[model samples]
Target: MHAGTSNFLKAFPIKFAILIATFISLLLVGCSDEAPGAKVPAFKAPDSKAAAKSGAPGGKGPGGPGGRGNKTFAVEGYIAEFHKPSGSFQTMATLEALNRVELSAAANGRLVNLYAKDGASVQKGSLLAKIDDSELKAQLKQAESSLHLAQQKMERTKGLVEKNAATTTDMEAAEASLKSAEASVELIKAQIAKTEVRAPFSGKLGFVNVSVGAWVTTGTSIATLSEVTKLKAKFALPQRYATTLKVGNPITLIDEERAIQKVGKVTALDATISESSRTRQIMVTVDNSKGELIAGGYAKVSVELQSGRTQTIPVPAEALTLDKDGAYIFVVQDGKASMRRVETGLRTPIAVDVISGLNEGDTVITSGLISIRQGSSVRIREIRNNTDYEVD
Candidate 1:
């Protein structure tokens, strides 16, 4: 082949390739120009003053370049005010029978008889059930026979001793034998009495756990007896009110489970306050002769205490925050949130008693607490009453 011809062929291919790339580039430029609004302008640096004013980098917003200004938070505010005294305090209480006991077998034997039916009312000392007492009775008879023999021997020995036919030791031995026989008789009689389950006091009986002819041992529970004529509601009160409550103060008992309400009177107060709970134990008595109250139930006990001061500064419970330092609240001071440490007292479901560190007209921030910082600029977007604030 000729060298010139080959070189010409290679140059022709390169020229063709260049032409194809140029055509493609021109096609792309034409497409871009035809597209609507596809043009981008040249970049330019933003003005410092405009950037700062718009809260961009190096602006007045919090955590910005300068870090000099705090972010303004929009929050709901509450107005503190005086609240009326509640005049009473409520606590959960448990109801108990004035006299309640679990009847159990005192001696081990077969339960032979159940004289009183379940839920039956009985008089004091009434026979409620009986265990098999045949063996005990037999033992008692044997002891009685022994007692009779000892008595006869003692009489003979006394007569002989009186005639100086028996020594003093013989008479003493006879007396000892008689006393031993008497003790045995009494012991057997006591055992027999234990076999008979009698009502300790007049009360209604619970369901018998054991049936007739069931073998029962000592301390085996047979049934429960409760004198429901009167009930005692037991509850605890705060230690602060220990001295204010008396034995005769009237209280209201509400059994929410049964929807029963009753008036009761305080009957007893514990001698000491419970250190663990910081409360004083108390008991209130209520009549249940109509069988309205149930033993072993729960009740809401409301104790009427002396009315507190009419003017009490109360704030929404959610407005208060706690930390290692103690409870503190955020109040708007000079358009900024200011943390004020506070001492709290009696609390209600919706409000807290601010004993100090807060004022009646203070505006407390109740919402947007998570975004709030000490001395952060705050804007009150909504106003709420003391008890109308939202939690969290």
Candidate 2:
């Protein structure tokens, strides 16, 4: 081959290789513009109104092509109703006697006399036990002797003064002495009274914590005395119900263990709400004149806010939602889910009392909560009563 021709052939091979590499790069760039099966289309300006209606970046509205407009969440709905009202709320309460006290020894001494029998009824001011007041009686006798002597001396001093045999100052001193002796006698008698244990009120006695001859100090418990003519149920109520609960409102007390139910009346309420628990203390007084109930037992207390029949709208509990803003629920309005802030009262396993923000005969969305949003289109596949809906 000629030298010039050979050089041209070698340069041609290098140029051909460069052309192949450029073609491969062009193919890669084309592939990068779209997925394997996708086709690139011409660009078009998004319609502002349609984009706003869709609430999305694309102009395809809910009903538009390539949009979620036609999509609707299938959910269960419940018709809220004004049902016959029952208890406003139920809470655990502690039962207390109308009057209860632990009788303690007023004076420190050995119990010389004790009438200790459990469940024994006693009368007010009755002597239950008498302590050994022997030393006190001796002191009283000594004081009486001194009192007698002082009385005699005072009479003599008065006579002397009238007869001009004694000074007025002397007579005054004698009278003062007589008063001092009388005080001493009374003091000894009061001390003797302390040695005896007397019933402060008419009630039944508990177990005798001390026996005769058992030495006890002041404030030592002897027995418990409880007046069970009536009972009090004490419980705490949420502060939100403070306005509805009044001093004379009726309440129901239930002893589940004994299956006993009794009606009671609100007697007292806390003046201020508790900051920590946001609740108010309540005391309900119940008639126990027949001795049907025992004190110091627990009871289930239910409060009635109204005098007679009450009506309140109730919704399925699952329909209720809570957030930092407080409780809310979703109601189907115009075939779309609309959220409503609600004030709720009592709640049951299946239903929640809607105090406000909802009305009777309103449709509440009970199911498909996870897939629904505010203003989302919803289709109620099944409509049921508020109490009939079950949470899945």
TM-score of 2: 0.62
Off by over 4 Å in 1: 1-84, 256-259, 307-392
lDDT score, candidate 2 = 0.84
Q: Number of clashes in model 1?
A: 0
Q: Which one is best on lDDT?
A: 1
How do the residues 169-248 of candidate 2 rate in per-residue lDDT, one tens digit apiece? 99999999999999999999999999988889988898888888888888989889998889999999876466678888
